[model samples]
Target: MEFRGRQTQKCPRCGGKALINQYKCPDCGLIFAKLDMATNKAASQRYKNREKSAIVFVKKVPIDLKRWKLILYTVLFGLFGAQYFYTKRWWWGLCYILGFTLLSVCVIFNAPLLNIWDGGLISFFGLIVGVYGVCWMFDIFKVCLGKFKIPVSLPKNELNAVILSKEED
Candidate 1:
């Protein structure tokens, strides 16, 4: 009956196939008329070539109360750590030293996939919950030890100013 091939021709005026090979409506004299893809595979293939997708990357994620507390403590400890290193305070560095010491000890002392739990996720939650519990107790101890000094002498408003001063130092 007829021949079919790749999209090889285009119209000059509208740049569409209507004026090139196919019949344009005699009454309208239109150059670009849409065709049903069900009968014309070549036309549908042209659209498929233009389709594309895009992706994006994000940095932060939502964390729970315990994780939030850990994040806060870690930030505070890290700031103290830097301060201690600068001011030559051995006591402030004790936690970082002890933490690394225990980590090295753990690496040196492995028991081939150690299993202390009774085959459940309890062991996973246990560490996080345990750390949170310890932090709670530590908070209580600090509250008992002294009038809950707000981490530093500078007020919330003065933190930026204090930071600027430290930057000058």
Candidate 2:
């Protein structure tokens, strides 16, 4: 795509029109780069293809600025919410007390009415069922937000190479 503003600054590499966002130049040839979103690593994170957290990723083109920020913020919020629900076990512990007490009372009062009155069995059941329900809900919320974060970093070598390849994406 055409870059904005005047054709003042020349590519540090090619010394051509310098119209590109990045470029590279050698005595042999010149290259220029176009910022495209598909090539961006941040945008790719929406797919979680990253093998490591420290690995760098970039988008060829920056996306809608405000929208990208919102997606990132929302994903962070979702992560924290999921962590709180899954880990901070204070609330869940209380539920354990209430559930066991209720089950014990039902068994004691009605004898044969509740077949699963064994204490170990009932607590195991509550823990698994409760964890499953919460995890399921948290996953659903995160999946609904969709794509986000087209982050790009200008690498020195690639930026220089762009001067020679200065074609639009």
Candidate 3:
């Protein structure tokens, strides 16, 4: 028998090699037919249930979050990350607050704005202001476009459940 051209597959659980025409894993005795049933019947059913629930309970923004309010926060207090806080992104809000504070401190200390004329554009003050400005503008743009990614969890209630008896064809 020529073994060189025979097709083979890897065992999922045991990571052992097996011929594609074989029924069970040679090393782990895992039945390929049972594995197929488990994946197709149970796993795919679960994924379909999840997908249906995801579509039914879809919310563009977080709970109690108004689009107008988010836009207002981004326009007015986005430099300090008020919009991020409202969207429940705490770490990002903290970063914005920290950047604003740093900028304020630099201004208080009368730090020079730029060293571009001195052939040293890599200086301190202007970089922080420039980056902060760009981020603030980008956040406002995203808020306006209604495309900001809000991290909110869907309610795990019966309303979001895909009742097996009521499932459609």
Candidate 4:
């Protein structure tokens, strides 16, 4: 009798073994049709002929976020946490509102400024408010420079469509 090895395929992502007829990876659940076997030639194209495209196209992804609105919120309503609320960051917006409220209470009660050891709660509130202001200022700069991180997300189907279209090119 002749010896023969079992026919199997290895998943490129997880290196898991599957029957040769299998269309999807059992371990990672990656479909064989979606697998990208192309070399770095696609990525290397960005580096060649860098003069014209480098300034306008390279490294820039088209996202749904608007820089003008973000900058406007950061500059105009930053003290009220408007930017965070606009960006859908509820927890950060709540924190900013709470900080503002605490600062307001401290001011109303005239909490001691120089009495640090004697329960000068105003100082703590002031520090928090100051830090909040500094963060708001930093966010203004980041939004202007197009470096602010937004939490927006694309639908999975749309994302997959974009990926498949790029692969077709």
Candidate 5:
């Protein structure tokens, strides 16, 4: 008795074992030869470089911010960009704070130069404030949904491990 269809190794792309002559994965149409030792070595080298870069970046991120805390700050002080400040994005935080303050001042003082522009400056500032408010609301929503992540170098699980290690010390 002769066996007709012998099983082979699983496909790396789709995990299918239906390989054709140990060259191509029939199930996923992935050519195994495309991933030779040279390709794998190059890929491994790139990954190591990226990992090293990420380690350096994670080391620089002083505060590992929590999602809930970011949401809370976004909700409480979004107008003043408190969340950005916590994320170490000083430029964005300062811009938001300054923009809000300037707009408020413009609206409250009703300056003489603004009046000379026939309320144009007030209207322009109002539009800016409205746009900023919408953006702030979206930011709050994104933070609550865990979409607005901090730009750390390591993966989430590894980053958490690092944070735990730091706390233990």
Candidate 6:
């Protein structure tokens, strides 16, 4: 009896009295379902446009490292943060490089000097090396398991679109 809370009970498009289950106008063959379909189609088209734009934007920004390549680099050179360098994390890469370099130099050059301190210097060196090895192995696992992601700054909508496009591929 009531359509969309309106008391008139007339088709809004043609002002016809024909109403089928409060959703159709038989005179004009217009249905509320068709309107919903049209709305959905329009929304789909808009999403497609956004996806296209996002793809174009992604093209402009170069992602130098591939997932497999990153994993390989991590396995081979993660102790020196080569993966971080490839991912454009300059600060982390620098820290890893410096840490590994300094630790290696200390272990190599201090071996003779540490002999005077008996096992104290050996234990310290072993601890540092163990920590570094553990970190390197963790990084390798993270990269190989696809848990590591390259950080990129993108607008929210564009980022969604880009992620969607990547998933499609």
The true-versus-predicted C-alpha distance at residue 59 of model 4, in Å, is: 11
Flag regions of model 6 displaced more than 4 Å: 1-64, 155-169
The residue pairs found clashing in candidate 6 are: none
Candidate 5 accuracy as lDDT: 0.57
Scored by lDDT, model 1 comes in at 0.32
lDDT of 6 by residue, 45-83 (tens): 444455333221111113333666777789888989997
Q: In candidate 4, what residue range of length 10 has the lowest lDDT sum?
A: 52-61
In order of appearance, the predictions have TM-scores of: 0.22, 0.25, 0.52, 0.53, 0.51, 0.50
lDDT tens digits by residue: candidate 2, 15-125: 445443334323324333333321333333423543332222221224433434434433453323332222222243355445445545544654343354645655565
Segments in model 4 whose C-alpha atoms lie over 4 Å from true places? 1-63, 111-119, 158-169
Q: Quote the RMSD, in angstroms, for model 4.
A: 15.0
Error of 3 at 113 (Å): 10
Q: Write down the lDDT that model 2 would get.
A: 0.38
Instruction: TM-score for candidate 4, please give it.
Output: 0.53
Give the CA lDDT, 0 to 100, for residue 156 in model 3. 36
Question: What lDDT tens digits, residue by residue, belong to model 3 across residues 46-159?
Answer: 334553322111124543567899899999999899988876566789989988987786666552533323524334655877798799999899889876766432233222
lDDT (tens digit, per residue) of candidate 1 on 1-169: 1225533334322333432355442323332222210111221232244311111011111111122443444445442333223222345456545544544444454343245434344444445445644644554444344322121111122111212222221
Q: What is the lDDT of residue 11 in candidate 2?
A: 35
In candidate 6, position 165 carries an lDDT of 29
- Backbone clashes in model 1, listed as residue pairs: none
Each candidate: how many clashes? 0, 22, 0, 0, 0, 0
Q: RMSD to the native, candidate 2?
A: 15.2
User: lDDT of each structure?
Assistant: 0.32, 0.38, 0.60, 0.56, 0.57, 0.56
How do the candidates rank by TM-score, highest first? 4, 3, 5, 6, 2, 1
* Model 4 C-alpha lDDT per residue in residues 13-56, reported as the tens digit of each score: 45678778776767766555433322222223323433212111
Query: Where is model 3 more than 4 Å wrong at Cα?
Result: 1-59, 111-122, 157-169
Off by over 4 Å in 2: 1-51, 55-117, 147-169
